[model samples]
Structures are given as C-alpha cells and as structure tokens.
Target: MFSPHGPSLRELAVQALSSVERGYDLLAPKFDHTPFRTPRSVLTATTEALAELGPFSKGLDVCCGTGAGMSVLRPRCPELITGVDFSAGMLAQARAAHPDATWVRADVRALPFAGHFDLAVTFGALGHFLPAERPALFAGVYRALRPGGLFAFPLGAPPPPTSVPYWAAVGFDLAMRVRNAVWRPPFVMYYRTTPLAALRDDLAAAGFTTTAPALPALGRRRDGSPRCRLVLARKPADPR
Candidate 1:
C-alpha cells in the first residue's frame, strides 16, 4: 500500500518496534509518499464539506501529520492556522511544508492551548488513541476551542458485516492486540475503536453539542447511507 519511495519493510519493522513518537519520527521524511498519509481525495472532500461552514477566524489541526490538513484550514480560517502533534519529526515536516502556519509539538491529551481557536479539525488520526485515552484528548480539544467554536472531522460509516472492509478492520484490530500483548511501547493504532456511537458519547461527555452531516462528495455505501460523514462538534455559544 506504500509507494516505492515510502519506508522499506525493514524501516517499517523498526518503526513498529519503536514508541509512537519515535516511529513517526522515523517515518516522517517519506511519510507523504506512504499510504499512511491521508489521501488527497479525502482531504479534498473534507475541505469542500468544511467550506460551506466558513469563515472561521482561527483554526487548529490536531495530530496534523505532514501538514496535509493545512489546505483544509487555510482557505476557511483567515485569521490564523496552527497544527499540533506529539511527533517532532512530523512537526518538522509540517513546518517545512507550511512555514507560514504555526506548528506545536505537544501531546494532544494535554493540549497547551485554552479556548484559543474558532475551529479545529482532525483527520485520520483518531485511531491512534485508545478508547480510554479518548476522553483526555477530546477534553483537551474542547478546552482548546472558544465557546461557539466548531471541531470537525470526517468519519467513515462502518462497513457492512459481509463487506471486505469489515473483515479487514476486524483482522487489523486482532493483529494489533496480539502485537501489543508481546510488544513494549505498544503502537496504539486500531481500525475499529472510534465507532459513531462511542464518538457521539465522548463528544457529549466533553460538553460538545454534536451533529453528523453527510459528506455528499464522498458518495454512498451499498446500503445507501453516506459512505462517510463530517462530525461537527460545537462548543455551546453560551456555556452558562
């Protein structure tokens, strides 16, 4: 699934054995060439979906790897744009790619900002946090946004039970469980952890009023549901 310029098998092995931060550090140089980077189609769809909700003043991209989300924020957020991630290597690549935008290297679970952004977005990065870890991360995002700010992300509808993607997600989670059982540092990515119900619950727990708007550009599933949706979590305009 990786391009020829992406990490080699040995390189991937080394990364998998390292902690999440170090692994991304090892992969940062060629990260854009890898399948691990969010696809352009997804990015474009997200940008389009978010454009309708514009003109946000300041934006934050949580766990923005290699700065792919900058395109989504730059057009919409006129005042400023910033990216945050735990990986120093990824931040370096992002800073190089979008030197004008701000980049912060800090764990998202304990985000440093407090009510500083008008809008926040994260893409393809939720799988990196465990279910128990989600509350902290979501709370941090909540604390980072001003009242009335929006936090958005694209979430795929779960695949049908008979679908190949369904089985693939199952297999991947099982393999990760086995790997973590024997491995130290425990790379935390999982394919099935952030299902819609769980996400809605977590967002509510974080005091966000949530909505799921279908991303029309992403098309429909065989069952006629939108294949994916952009989850819009808004901090209340009046927190009183």
Candidate 2:
C-alpha cells in the first residue's frame, strides 16, 4: 500500500496473519519497492563512515533482505562477501540482485557461521528480535566474524516523547504487542525495543567491544544530537 509497486493492504493483512518468516516471504517480491527498504541516505552514510575502519578481507551481510548491504560491503572487502537470511524468498531476491555473492538461508537468532568474515553488517533488521532474542543474535554474529572483525549497523536516535514520531512508534509497538498476543503465529517486530544503551549491554555480553559514532551524514536532530549513529561492535582480537 505504500506505492504503486508495493504490496496491497489485503496482501499486507495476509502477511501479518502468517508467521514472521512467512510474512516476509510474502512481502519479499515487493520489499524493495516499499518504504521498508533501508533508505539510500542511511546506506550511503554507513558506507562512507565504515570505509575508514575497513580494508577487510571478507564480509557478510546478516539478515540480508534483498542484499542491499552487499553494496556497502563490496568495495572495502575485496576478497569475498556473503548474505544470510532465513527467508528463502528474500534470499531469492538478494541472489538475483547480486548473483556473485553467496546467499545462505538461516534464521538470524541462530546464525550459522564462525570465524569466517572480517566484516559483517546488518541494516534495518534489528527490530525483528525481542530483547531476550538479542543475545543469541549478537553471539552468533560475534562467532561469525574473525577475531577483531567489525559488525556495524546504523541506528537512529529515538524521538523525544513530545514528538509525533515518538508517539507513532509507541502506537506501532503497542499494536504489534496486541497483534502478537492474539495471532496464531507471532510476527515479532517492535520499533522502540532497541535503544542504544540496551544494545551496548547485549553486545558487551556477547564479547563485543562496542562503540557508536554519530553519523553526521544523516544530519542532526532538533536537539542538535546526531540523527543516527553507526554501531560498530568489534569482536576482540583475542576472544579470551
């Protein structure tokens, strides 16, 4: 319903009634056409900011919906790159868009890899997991990367309570909680769940040394703080 090329309201309703994996599979064909696709500005900003920390040998895109992140990973990681996600339909789109890169189908909560990639990135996919599910996801990403490898993703600044976007997010999350409570198969997505502090704690528990550098490319909020920050979670060179 977002655009001419996007899914219709009926299609979206059908998808929502299904499981998260199934819902995404139904949406996969029109996913890129929707507002849900990671914004170009975010991708461009992330690519530029991440460039300085890289020259990485290999890269990975976690929960890679349609492989948009492969573009960010390609230049700096000259050797090879791969994308992984649970939905076969999403993988189909990603594989078609970027045939040169490997696409593996697997759930992000239990990502399957270890010590293989020097750089890994995920974009616009964090809200899929609940607070309790983050540890497994973070741990898996930690294990997927080579020691000292970097895992980066762009995180937006939360809106203040006074703002329209803040209330919108709260309403959206509350709707999701209600939907999940009543639905047969839960579609687990929430807007307000992943704040910076909670994210840092989860990453730390997963053995990542975390830093969030403000993305000036995304501009500043009304309060003059950054509109977005890139979370750079590095696996210790020595995982001891």
Candidate 3:
C-alpha cells in the first residue's frame, strides 16, 4: 500500500530489524509516502470534529512526525502551534515543512512542558507505545495541557478476526514478540495492544474525562457501528 516514493521491501526489512528510533530515522524521508502516514481523510474528519469543539489558543501535536496533524491544529488554535517528537530525523523533516511552527525534540513518555497548551493532537503514534506505557504517555499529555484543555486522537475499530487484515496484524504482533524476545533494544509496536476500555481507564486515572465521538467522515461498518472514533479527553478544570 506504499507509493512509488515509499520505502522498498529491503528498507522496511531493515527498519523492522532495527530499534524503533533508528527504524523511524531510516523511514523519515519517505514516511509521508507510506501507508503509515495518517491519511488525509482522517485528518480532514478530525479537523471538522475539532472545529465544533474548539476555538482553542495554543495547540501541541504530540509525536508529530512530519507535522501532518499541524494542519488540523492550525485552524482550531491560531496563537501558536508546537510539534514534538523524540525522532530527530522526523522533527527535522517537520521543521522544513512548517517553518512557522515550533518543533521540539522530546519524548512523549516524559513530555517537557506543563500547562502550556490548550489542545493537543496525535496521529498514528500510539501503536509505537506498548499497553503498559500508555498511562505515562497519557499522564504526560495531561500535564502539558492547561485546565479544561483537550488531548485528542483518532482510533479505528479493530479489524474482524475473520478478515485478512486481522490475521496480518496478528502475525505482525507475533513476529514482533519473537523479535523482541531475541533482540536487544525492544521495538514496541503492536496493533492490537491498546483497547478502548483499557485506554478509557488509563485516561481517567490520568485525570481526563474521556469521550469517543463517532468520526462520521470515515463512515460506518456493516453492523452500523462507526469505523473510527475520535477520543476527546479533557483534563479536569480543577485537578484537586
């Protein structure tokens, strides 16, 4: 599902075998050309949803690779926008693309800000975090936002077990488990690790009131359920 400019099979193989940071560094230049990039359809849908909920001041894009989510933040929050990522290569590419915004090199697990933003968005980055690590990530995001601020991201419904995509994801996760079992510097990326229930609990524990809004732009499934939902998490106005 990659474009002509996307990484080759050998390049992907090398990336899969390397550490997450190194793998992303190798993929940074062509990341936007891959299926891995957050699709424009999702971006547009999220922007529309946020428009109804916002008129925010400052926005932050957590793990903002190539700054795709920055466009969504731009319309919702006008004063300032910041994109943060631990990947130097990805941040460099993002900086070149959006010179008007600030780019900070920092890990999402330990975000380096407090009460600095009115809204935060992340795209296609959660899979890189293991289930056990989500609490810390959510906490960091919570700490970065001002009172009554939001941390939003889109999450798709899990693929059916009867589908090819389901088996593919299962196989990919199995392979990653084996790789981590045998390799140094574990590369944590699992498609099925984060579930809605667990995530809701984690967000609540981190002091956010979470809501899942149906992303109508993505349409519905055969069962009439939403294909994707945007997780809108608001940090309580008073943490005390």
Quote each prediction's TM-score: 0.98, 0.98, 0.98
**150-171, model 3: which lDDT tens digit per residue?**
9999999998889999999999
Clashes of 2: 0
Model 1 regions lying over 4 Å from their true place: none
* Candidate 1 residue-wise lDDT, 208-238, digit = tens: 9999989888899777899889999999988
In candidate 3, stretches whose alpha carbon ends up further than 4 angstroms from where it belongs are none
lDDT of 2 by residue, 1-240 (tens): 288989998998999889989999999999999888999999999999987997798999999999999889888788999999999999999999999998899888888898999999999999999999999999999999999999999999999999998999999999999999987899988999999999999999999999999999899987899999999999999998
User: In model 1, where is the ten-residue run with the lowest total lDDT?
Assistant: 46-55
The local distance difference test score of each candidate is 0.93, 0.93, 0.93
lDDT minimum window of 10 residues, candidate 2: 1-10
